[model samples]
Target: MIVAPYMLKAFLCSVGLTWMRSRSPGAGISRSWARALPCKPSPAGVAAVVGTAAVPPCCFLQQGQLSLRGGLRVPPCAFSTLGWWMVGIPPDTAGTSSVGLRAERSPVFACSPMDLSELLKEGTKESHDRAENTQFVKDFLKGRIKKELFKLATVALYFTYSALEEEMDHNKDNPLFAPLYFPVELHRREALAKDLKYFYGEDWKEKIQCSEATQQYVDRIHHVGQHEPELLVAHAYTRYMGDLSGGQVLKKVAQRALKLPSTEEGIQFYVFDNISNAQQFKQLYRARMNALDLDKNTKERIVEEANKAFRFNMQVFDELDKVGRSLGEEAQDGGVPVHDGKGDIRKCPYYADKLGTAGPSCPFHAAVGLARQPLVQLVLAACMAVAAGAAAWYIL
Candidate 1:
């Protein structure tokens, strides 16, 4: 029987995602199954079948042959055309490979069971989500940030990065952490100092003191750098990669929210002068991290430490949230408003929460309520009636 092309594509994508997900820590897939599937199906090959580009590299169709790990090969035409070549292979003839291809079992193309970058990403995903959803981060994203709170947040970052960079400097030469060190590209302490100077003037150093939460985070960084130097990789990866990922977006939000100057003064901490291409630099950094000489246990510990770093950040955010509550100042106005392109005001989380509340905060709801008033309704109805009568007279 001929298998439909879409069916074959779906099967391949399912296999690809399964292999990719199984590589994460605590994935329930059996070790033998993971070894059998090998590297994720290459995006090009999967895209050729599925019409979307995603998934990491490994099995791919080259020239005319589809090459997968474990020495399994199939012609591109097998799935491209409607044929039984793919589906007709007997189960008994299929060897170690799961896709019914004869397994030749070569060791040359074998991939490591885990990469440090993927491990940290998957393991700390929950912690990252919690940190992002915290009230401070959510408010900042919505441009509801007060200038005072923003400056205090900058102060916290200055202290955190100062400690992190100091530790990174001491471990820069060590074999365990050396590959990941990129002072010019990734360090933010100097940039943060510039931001503080802009916000608090030349006496910024004396005006800003580390908050209790921030001090705890700094102490942890120092402790990790001094005693468990190898685990410093966790803090570096967590902070620098996260900053690189979200820095520009946050910078734009802060600039608009606080009405900061266009010269990039107060938001200097988010600007990476040395790194021209953040994406390529991040890929290079992850590659270097994967190349490190580390065992499974060490890698697990590093993932745990990265989660700890995320926790420390969340604690700092909580402290900022508490401080924001006590301040009498209103959140800055004239900030850029968030739009989801649907134009429905209720869709915005910030506006949705304030929708029916009394005040000028929700003008849309106020207008809606006014339209429902008997006097306003009567006036609107009279206007519509007059316009209809005028149209009728014109037609006559």
Candidate 2:
């Protein structure tokens, strides 16, 4: 029995995708997926925001309206049908796959990690571990004496960190000022005071100052290190899109599992609009992942590790998710007025979000609105004084 090959394997095994070590003789690892969901144009970039009635609409849902044009309904996954395939790195035994989109692997909450593959394969590290407990971290420490597992473990942990980092990076520079996706940006304007406080525990800003790697990532992407928490929140918003977006299917599923109403709105803040023809692209993505160069063992290890990463993510979320309930937010009605219970008028914004923050149409952010106008007045005053000085000198 192979106990473990790598620490990532152990972590992955702890979470479940460990069955990937063997190759089915006839099956190709590269499989086709559905299609890519259309990503809306970045608000500051080239992404096209779908109008309420845009015919060639790329993103299905827009503003506050779902696309009735294409009968845009939620599939098994709120992501486009091909979402799984797009995220799939290696195709499963099936010719077509729901690899990434669907929750294929079961989540495990383990305190300790172990890789059973090594025990069976090379059987090299049979010395230290004796009574590896299946439940807690202490038990796992008590069980194995595998020397090689530690090296593999480092890789697993590093890989997990990288994935988490990437997840955050993708959002930080998204060019879309839609904090409705991650509502805390309102707090970020005054981020120096509240950012580290609300998100990080304490002295968090100083902690970022020490991270050269973080600074490097930010510099590479044209952002500052302080932006990391923003990215983290952004990534978190994307990953737990169900909580953020009003994914009724996800809500129903979660509601049934956890015993709550799926329609419990004002609970999340995310935005992943349904893209068209999402089913066919996933297979294409699976091909892309498998195409990456690696030997069989390493490949399998990556797959297992990726799944393990998901589990690790779940653990992180387990700790952080509780904070979701305490979130102070609400769904916007695309900038329309609302009536209070007593029938008083409530103000809504057009491009400004729930935070009274602005985007595309915000006057507060405009140079002409926020600074340039005043700056021009000051410059004019200075220029007039200078002209008067010159005239007085000439007359004298």
Candidate 3:
């Protein structure tokens, strides 16, 4: 008879448990499972068979080793109960035994104890930190940036999220996305459009231009949507969750700094009218993700995609920083506020690379250029002498 590997493993487990019961007083075996029964002693050391349940026949047995039809290997009929702890196998299949079975073939649906949420957190930690530490975000929150810079950021975000949400909508029918897809509750297109109108006036459609970085990000999303739709989950998670959390904080900061009223026109992008409670909605989203039927490999791929999403966001920040640097001359010429009578531009490492020197708009560079001109130097010396004489006259 053809014996399934699982059945053979069950038979071996029952034999081992019955032997233990005979030797030990009131053995740990559940009475309802294996009732005591009499039988002739076998060379396998099984003194009795305790249950009437039918066990399939083994394909081959040699040298005290039992070989089953399926790909299973047991040397000396050895088994441990630990592997069954978190598995979904039936408890009564092996005469109420909990022993772990050995199989040459891997389990049908292998999973990690860590669910989707933990996987995302661990996988994207580095990328998340990099995104947060970007100079563009720091300056934006501090209110030391121009409104035009903020508008540029919003435009880039519009393009990125537009691509992502479009892919998600198209792939909503996919089995993997169906569970985690909450388009109505988490969608940002309408809100972003309202904010765009506020930023660029009614002609935002004609004025808005996507940065190169944003184009690259959108292209990646499109590629993934066509070739690997499952990856869109990671991008959705990265953008939506961030918009709910840090994005809200930025909204309040920008409103206060830019003196924008708390209206849809100014801050609609951060407003989630559909989702009243961000934390509760986030928990529900995570629960859906946790309940997804994904294998270990698929989960790993999603995690990698999430890290890529963060990298894309950081690239947008870099592009925004470049845009901000282009406005340095304007900022120095009273287009934006000056920090203590000088350019209010931040001289962080990111901007330092763009400007080629430190300290806002590089006042030192202007001084050096003026010093190179002999006429400018002679005029400066004459002014200093006149100022010195005026100071002496006033003192006298």
For this target, which candidate reaches the highest lDDT against the unseen true structure?
Answer: 1
Q: List the residue pairs that clash in candidate 1.
A: none
Ranking by lDDT: 1, 3, 2
Q: Which lDDT tens digits does candidate 3 get at residues 1-396?
A: 233444445545545554554433222233212122221222443221102111221111122332212223222211122122111124233221112222231111111237677798777766665665788866665555667787887888789889988888888777677655666677888888888998788989999887788999999999999889878878888777777665665665566556677564668887877664564355445544654557789999999998888788788888888888888532311212222222111211111112222233446755775664545545555565555555556655
Q: What is the C-alpha RMSD of each candidate to the true structure, in Å?
A: 16.5, 30.3, 26.7
What tens-digit string does per-residue lDDT give for candidate 1 at 1-396? 133444445445544554555443223233234345424344454322111112123342222343333342322211111111212223234332332223222111222448787788678767766776788877776677888999999999999999999998998777688756667667898899999999899999999898999999999999999999989999888777766666555676678778889899999887877655454355445645665668899999999998898888889989999999898877475433432222223212111222222134346755875765545655565565555555556655
Sort all candidates by TM-score, best to worst: 1, 3, 2
Q: After best superposition, candidate 3 residue 324: deviation in angstroms?
A: 0.9
Better of 2 and 3 by TM-score: 3
**Residue 366 of model 2, lDDT score:** 47
Instruction: Estimate the lDDT of model 1.
Output: 0.63
Question: Highest TM-score, which number?
Answer: 1
Model 2, span 276-376: residue lDDT tens: 11222222222212222234554344334323323333343332223333444433223212111111001100000121221323343444444334345
Clash number by candidate, in order: 0, 46, 1
